[model samples]
Target: MELITNLPVLAAILATFLLAGLVKGVIGLGLPTIAMGLLGMVIAPAEAAALLVLPSLVTNIWQLMDGPKLGPLLRRLAPMQVAVAVGTLLGLWAGLLPGKGGATAGLGAALLAYAAFGLLPLRLPQVPPRAEAWAGPLVGLLTGLVTAATGVFVLPAVPYLQALGLERDRLVQALGISFTVSTLGLAAGLASGGGFGGGALGGSVLALLPALAGMALGGRLRGLVSASTFRRCFFLGLLILGAHLLWQGLH
Candidate 1:
């Protein structure tokens, strides 16, 4: 309590998590992306990454278990999952370079890329099954590297999953599988970098409460709210937030 009593930071962290969890509850994605993007405004991307470790892991694990097909999903995604972990370690190596603004700038660039991808609605041509054999691992690698660097893991990964031609429900479950693996990889990356030596654990735990509450609220709203409308609002909001983070990081 004493540590988080500092009003500004605590308020910011809690608000970020609540908002993020609401987005996830409604759209089934964007927890880390929203949390990290918003938190980066008040803290470094690295510290924000550290703070998200626990909540991301917990939420993703819940999602991963919600379906009965976990065994097949795990087996199918094994290559991509392994590549993601490797890429995360590689990105952590780059994140270790001593610099003033590089990590922030990198995070900003990632935000810009993500925002652009979202706003434009660009859909890649679906890859043939043979291609996925290679493309899956490649996309996972890129997603993992980005996750390690900016604490946001959506980039090529989400788009890649979308292109998989799975049914809607299966797609959602696939996201859970990908996110669960990615969260674990992120924890390892941050741990290796000494990002959790201080009060990050307490902060993350405190933030989790609001996140879960917001998810419950958003879950209820899902029946009442138009998802497409909410998604439009969400992405537009992310566009604005991403722009702000980019500006802050560079200037």
Candidate 2:
């Protein structure tokens, strides 16, 4: 891929992934969000998505395995995951995945919404235990559509998960599980669309190195920083990036 061959682009990719991984390490999320928001500026959204697959998949898998409640979580979330896969493939077949021009605007909108959710004092209604049967699938389906369009899947899904009233550790693990599935769904969609060829796959693998390193560093720094303060700054950054992309797309 040109991204790998071009020194400047490669450097940007490495640095972007490193920063993204650091965020994920400290906060337990944001790898795909940060990577997509930054890399989307330098590359096509599809190419950015392709480059994101491996690092996201690997890191999320690590997160998923860290908790002891995997079995229970999977049993609770299985339906949602199935819907995520189905919705992603359906979105691909429907050609909802962004192409050149429209994709930028769509990605920008997704990022803006996600950032706003984080920055706002929004309180979603708690999900009653009985509601999971339907709510889970609905949220998953919407998340898959967003993932297909923007390669970032933290909209209704994140909110929905939060509403489920899981314990802190369980919630984190659930997020990992959901994100892992979303990444796989996205990978399949990209591959079917011919966006995940060997070059893109190779670039993604290469990107993993810096991402992992950044995660290690972020893990070490987590103890020294106030998470709430860092989170505020992170959302603010996303807000600016999202606005820029939105403006660029509109023009």
Candidate 3:
């Protein structure tokens, strides 16, 4: 594949990363989600994920470094993270199936689903702790499958987290930790498959620099927006992106 490193494409990539980072900075968990949603239209899902990996990791590091102090919050969410990681592997396996388009379709569907749910008045029922165990496996599988294309996995968990009444800080922290593991897992899976090298990977890594810069800038501006306003605007953006992806995939 020919890499587009021309000045205009480079500028576009930087702008996209900045938008993604700004969204994440404002919302606490949308850097890759926003970036991949937008970028997947222009690049392969795997490539999009690869590009966002570094930025997601770098941004989340600060979020998670402070997470250790939130003991109860960490304890409650750790299991879900474990489940997402496990499910991601299964998703990857399914993704690798020849011509199945499991990863690509699943990623797009998950994003659409997440965006739609976010826009609606959706809530999850509280299950007993034992039943809660099942959520991890399901989410993991979904995360893995979706990661193959868009490199974003937390969509499956969004509703659950929103319903859990988690404060913004805890939710963001949990997401950061979840993505940290997801990114590492994806790297390992790609390595084993001998994927994501050559110009594509280099381009992705280079793209990550601008993404991080954008996120940093956005994080700085996050305080200016009211929570409710941000929430509304965020969902609207997701809705638009989701519809666009669905159209792209179906056609």
Q: Report the Cα RMSD per candidate.
A: 2.2, 1.1, 2.8
Which is the better candidate, 2 or 3, if ranked by TM-score?
A: 2
Candidates 1 and 2: which is better by TM-score? Answer: 2
Candidate 3 per-residue lDDT over residues 1-251, each given as its tens digit: 25455666566667788788777767777777787777776666666666666777777776676555667766776777666666566656656521235444555676777777767876777545666566655665566555654577566666666555667677677777777777776766665565656665677677677767776776777778787788788878877777777666776
Q: Residue 5 CA error for candidate 2 (Å)?
A: 1.0
Top lDDT model: 2
TM-score of 2: 0.97
TM-score of each: 0.92, 0.97, 0.85
Residue pairs with colliding backbones in model 1 are: none
lDDT of 3 at 43: 62
Model 1 TM-score, 2 decimals:
0.92
- For 118-168, candidate 2 gives per-residue lDDT tens digits of 899987899998999999999889888878877887887888999999988
Rank the models by lDDT, top first: 2, 1, 3
**lDDT of candidate 1 over 1-251, digit per residue (tens):** 23377798888989889888888877778899888877777776667777787878787776677777778878877888888888887877776321234556666677667667766868777778888789989999998877776777787788888887877777778888888777788777666677665577787788888888877777788889998788777877777877776677677
lDDT of 1 at 139: 92
Worst 10 residues of 2 by lDDT: 96-105
